[model samples]
Target chain A: MSLPLLEVDDLHVTFNTASGPVHAVDGVSFTMESGDSLGVVGESGSGKSVTARALLRLFAITDDVRIAGSVRFDGVDLLRIDERKLRDVRGGQIGMIFQDPLTSLNPLMAVGEQIAESLRLHRGMGRSEAAAEAVELLGRVGIADPERRATELPNSFSGGMRQRVMISLAIACRPRLLIADEPTTALDVTVQAEILLLLDELRRSEQMALMLITHDFGVVAATCEDVQVMYAGRLVEKASMVHLFDRANHPYTEGLLRLVPRFEDAHTGRLHPIAGQPPITGGGGSSCAFAPRCSHAFDRCRSEVPPEVAVGPQHLSACWLAAERAKDATEAGRPWKRDP
Target chain B: MSAAAARAVLEVSDAVVEFDTDGGRITAVDGVSLQLSTGETLGLVGESGCGKSTLARAILQLVPMQQGSVRLEDTDLGSLSPRELRRMRHRIQMVFQDPRGSLDPRMSVTALIGEPLRVHGIGDRASRAREVAEAMELVGLPALVADRLPSELSGGQQQRVGIARAIVTDPAVLVCDEPVSALDVSIQAQIINVLDELRDTLNLAMLFIAHDLSVVRHLSDRVAVMYLGQFVETGTASEVFTEPRHPYTQGLITSVPRADTESAARLQTARRLVLGELPSLLDPPSGCRYRTRCPYATDRCADVEPPPDLLDGHHAVRCHHHRAITAGEHQPSSKSMRG
Candidate 1:
């Protein structure tokens, strides 16, 4: 097989807190092909966003932070790159859109100038050419009357429009990969759909890979072709979107799926929530991180960390009881259905 | 007023809330009329700036209503004096969206829940502690957590403490304004289940307000869909979810990503969304607020406001072209569904 467009191997990120060193990202790994959309899903502080930021080297590396990993993009190891080279690759070759658009864009600059600034810096285009490109990009993202809206500040746009502007700026450099961190969190449901669609269209048209970091499974199902489920700073499950949704092997994945409210399901009794909260990560990472929250956890699960086992083609789950559950389902004549 | 057999714990008649901003006087809640019977759960679903939160606040008298009246049981909320209102406030409580911001950091869980009862002079010291313990138990928090500060607990636990504080007074009406929006999905479900169990055990009347229809659909008996400042549609949960009348309602239902759906096309086709954004509430469109985004909008829609037309005994919609829109005759060539 050809090398992945972006390959992450044995990534480990830790932060030194007063309590101890928090193992935020523990040996998390994934690979993405060109134009492939991969979703990194987890609850808050699951280390999903931190892992994304690590790809861009956003975290400070002092005596506090200890980052050891290999992140290869276009055959270049991002971890080994110097600050100057990393800066060039950060926004030019790889753009990022943050959760809050209001804070992401500069309040002092006009919305259009922000987009043009990226274009001028990265593409080395003339001022007039960059300005024209900025307006065109604004129009492309579904902003009406781009010329007038371009001159307006970020405060002038609504939450949805500001997000569109952020997306416009991110894509202005035509980066090979776009890392969007909870891009739709601040927007309403209708506006969320619109922004997702816009991103989808841009990804398809530009053939740019998208790394969407969010906790919403619905958003993951809609946009991502592959998914990685994180729990307590580790990747517990990774699979194609279809397999993850239809035949989720991991207990955590199953719990997450059941947690989301579906439109078709009638209001029965209360929702079946996973018992207990996620554990806080400390330096020591010998035991299974999810053992405290897992109902099916055994003595082995509590004492030893489970290794990632291949459940199916392109599917992996790190849980001791997944095989047992799969066997039980099969014996009960309620086998997991595979998507055609 | 008491003609209906069911006793209403809370009722708002054509309640309107307006805010005076630099732009102008914005009608946040326009002519919204609703009723929450004793022990009943009413879901208020809408987009941001649709005035759902404002309406919830108006019921608790947190925000002063510009017009109409809110009545809790036999008492008129708007006409109550300061002393009377303070006494009545214990009968109604609220849980806001942000648990961290809503809760006092310095206060312990014990103190946070016990403060309301103490303020109301409901019991002595020992009895108040017992009440606090009972409230904590009602929301499924551990007894040990009572001594912990709000900062020591997780987001879900903080919200549970918020719920405990709201219920400590044993309020007849509980108004939850986007209580779970800020929580994670797993934590959100836990909080929602806690709320559901509390309502069942206490027989409490609740106004569950949220921006997501799916969340509200699970908890509410009857759901009201608000657009701009007005309720465009209202009906029983089953009737509204399966058979939405208003175009905006249909669009909202469609916009939500369903687990059963395989493609965005199918989802988009399910609810054909109108192109433009929501018009400004200060200087809204001349006629119906939704007319600006309604696909079946006509010149009549722009000129005269559409009145709420009853589709059935329980379901109602505000649209000039409900007949054609529901019949799917005037639907655009997209994948939007017809009634």
Candidate 2:
């Protein structure tokens, strides 16, 4: 059988700061198959973006930061590859787009030239041919009047337009995977919906895997098929989108799902915000990181780290409750249910 | 109607704010009018460049209006002298979006929260310190963190400090301009809860301006939808959000991704998305400012500005075809609606 498109095993990313070592991503592991669309959902300091950057090894080589893990893309470990080969894998095989497009894109170069350069470098296309294809790429991404818009600088484009340009640039080489980090957070909801539609369309047409990192659950509900929730630099829950919405195994996930006020929800009274704050990372203990904030956390959760337990067919949750439920087969459904 | 009108602590009429740019004169805030009653929250929601913030500034007379009147209780701020305006500052306060950016980094939390009280010269040295500690506790901050700098606090803590500063002088009207947008989801909930509780306790007339529809729907009693510097629709939160009349308002409501499983399943099929981004405020559309991106735009929508069509003196929509659109009589231009 063919290997999964991407497999991340025991990924740990730490930074040695003035205070101590900050464990941004701790023991996170997941697998994605070809053309799979996964959403990495988390809040600030939750290590969602750090995990993505770690996959690309995008951090500058430094003594302060420590990265240890195996990231297998199509059965090959990206960490073992040399810089020359890693460069080919970065833009040619896997493409990345960040939150701010203006910073990611060149301010002085023409928008089309930016895309063309990527195409010429990665695909070895002629300059003139790449330029012609760049216009086509812009049109594919929902940019109107691609020909004229292509010659304009990044500063000339609006936020939404600049994001479209960034997408076109990333997809110029027809990369097998695309990692978009908060791609539409800065745009209006209407523009955000359009960009989401464009990304969904491109994923279908190109059959490319997508790893969309965002903090908004609604955005993930709109696009991703599978959702992975991160908290305190650890993966708390992983499940299909429908199952995650229906039966969130982890308390942290349940808290997030309940707290986020849905515009569609009928007036549900006051929001039940999760009490306490996320703990500081890099304590390096064998305890649950989310125990401090988790409402259902117990003494065991505070003392011992919970292992990934199978809660459903393809669902896994790293909570002691999940392990308890497995031990007692008679106890069905989630241990805790949200108030009606 | 009379009871509500009597309770109105802040009234704005025909508020017009303009800025001169290199391109031309841009009407950032067009002729907009709103009334915020005591203990009532009015959510001002719009995309970027819709001039929601500018309108907030106009209400406080922070920016000079081209031609308008801002009346706080019995006083008209337009006729107030510079000294008089300064004196009136304590009555109405504003909390900004970027908590870290708005707070003075050099000052301690206690000092930051106490600055407004100090500026207004309300209390003596000893009394000011006591009041500062009280405000800090009111926003759920501990007394020990009072000595810490703004940089030491988390985003949520920083925002709490900002809210504390705004309410320290016991302002009657609190204008929060996207106060929780920069925070994380969990912390955003905390800050939102704090704001809601404070509004109830203080009986403050709050204009909670934010682009987040969910948060606005949660905190607001009344909601106003702005497009290209004009109020396209205004009504009770339920009326505006559940039964949106204006096409622009409808688009904004439908654009928010439905989180429920049943509705999310229908997301791909149901397409009432807005056509394009907000048009340039420099040269806004002649008639209905939203006509450029509105799907139900007709010849009348382009030729003449649609006057406000009030429904029972509560809900108002500014669209020529709102009636037809509401009754499902008009068809959106299929070509532009999809893209």
Candidate 3:
């Protein structure tokens, strides 16, 4: 029937740094339907944020950056569209919230005015009408006494309140897609739960597709139905939330999962930390980027990159061992042993 | 004396720290007290502005306290002479949250780790350099990176340097204030392992202050839950995590996101969900600071302040309704402010 709400095909983003060309987001592909929630998990420099920003052409201003591949959102290829149309699509159809609200929100303006400005530009409301809607939006985001709080500057609000103002600004136009990049990373656990619940409620009420990019697996399990695990700017694993936790196929995914200390693991002797840091690859290579740090890596992983293989329905893992084990399990007529 | 008392390297009692801000006087550490024994980890956890950091600094005597005392192995830190205090400071050291910001970008790693020893006149220059190299190796940093600046090191390596500097003095107690919060998840695990190894090897008692519940539970022997400059609960790690008594402790535990899918629904139904942000320190709630957002709060919570009442041996809870709440006798009168 109809196409998905958002389809990303072989996305690649490279930046010309002082050292050399850095392939930050390399050949990532995914799709999302309306009301779908997808979590992108990766460590710093894994290029999770770069992929999300590339969709909105947010990197157009950077002089030494190259973004390639098709990003089709609601039938329009966002990359090929003109600057004017892209502006209309930016905050109007695809809203985004960043990690830190202090830098994202305008420091000089009143918090309400920033939201109103977006509404006036995107929704075509008059100044006064937009101002009233801004207050309402603030209240909708659970800000107390929105009328008075709206008049105050961004600095007057606490970290959590500033984030709420940012959320209000993003959803002022009721965009069809919401991209939240580490929205709760800077917030406390109590406030983070509140914010996540708020975002979940908004997504359901508006029927918007959500793409949440964060390093925390806990946040992903709590909010998303599907998830993609990234390592060294590559999509190493993609699966349903339950399936990912239950039967993660990629070594990187398994290692990352083990890194988190669970409440049940209290007094556990030591954390099973991945041995090495994520690499900063300057250019493309045939070998898998994560091979240096992966404990399960072998000669094939060091020589050539692995292709995406389906370990189960809707579960894709890019690893040679996973492919080999899948074959072995099929031959033996049994499920593959994860540890063995 | 008890075995715990005999082994304790740090003893802090009735510590009060206040600041004269433009809004008014704010009490950062309000009569907080704890004991940290050798080779033990006492996790001090709370939301931001809850005075966990202040308490850590007060223990180190970095911040001046309004009242109470901090003793380092029978020696009162507050009563020490200036020279003696400088010597006493060497027995306790701090590792800050932001490794890059805390470290000097201009200095090499060797100098950064050796500064404490140099300042304390612990050894000759050559001996200090040797100690620096050993400390770097102890934290899993390669010796080749000793000459590099903090800016050149990776986030994980920079944190290793921070840890190296803290232990270079061979401190009896190590106060890590959000040590791994700035790093990524994988890097955070590495740092935690390093800290764990160091604590065991050196027999260094650690005061691990963080907002991360899982990390605290992983490393701590005991846990103290702080809210609005006061400890709401203090108990063994297992008791605090599995059977949190205070409403604030329950709410905080519930807020943590779990990776397992089977427990997701259980976490939600068991959630206490304390609403709203931390209140202004200058004008905290009259009685229980957590009562403003606590679902089980009532008129008694506002009318009278609850002391830290000991229950079930050493598990202490600062809540008037904790006994009834644990007995299933008290009902929540108010819901969380929002979904």
Tens digits of per-residue lDDT for model 2, B1-339:
132664788999999999999999999988999888888999999888899999999998989999889999869999989999999999999999999999989999988998998888898999999988888888999988989999899888999999999999989999999998888898888998898889888989999999989899989989999988889999988889988898778777777876555534344433454775677877788888888877778888789999999987479999998888768898887665452
Question: Which of the two candidates, 2 or 3, achieves a greater lDDT against the reference?
Answer: 3
1 against 2, candidate with superior DockQ: 1
TM-score to true structure, per model: 0.95, 0.96, 0.96
Cα lDDT tens digits, model 2, A69-175, are 89999989997888899999887899989899998888999999999999988999999999999999999888889999999999999998999999999998898
After superposition, the stretches of candidate 3 with alpha carbons farther than 4 Å from their true spots are A60-63, A324-340, B1-6, B262-272, B335-339
Q: Alpha carbon lDDT of residue B10, candidate 3?
A: 89
lDDT value for model 1? 0.85
* Predicted structure with the largest lDDT when compared to the true one: 3
lDDT of each: 0.85, 0.86, 0.87
Error of 3 at B12 (Å): 0.6
**Model 2 chain B: worst 10 consecutive residues (lDDT sum):** B262-271
True interface contacts retained by model 1: 0.58
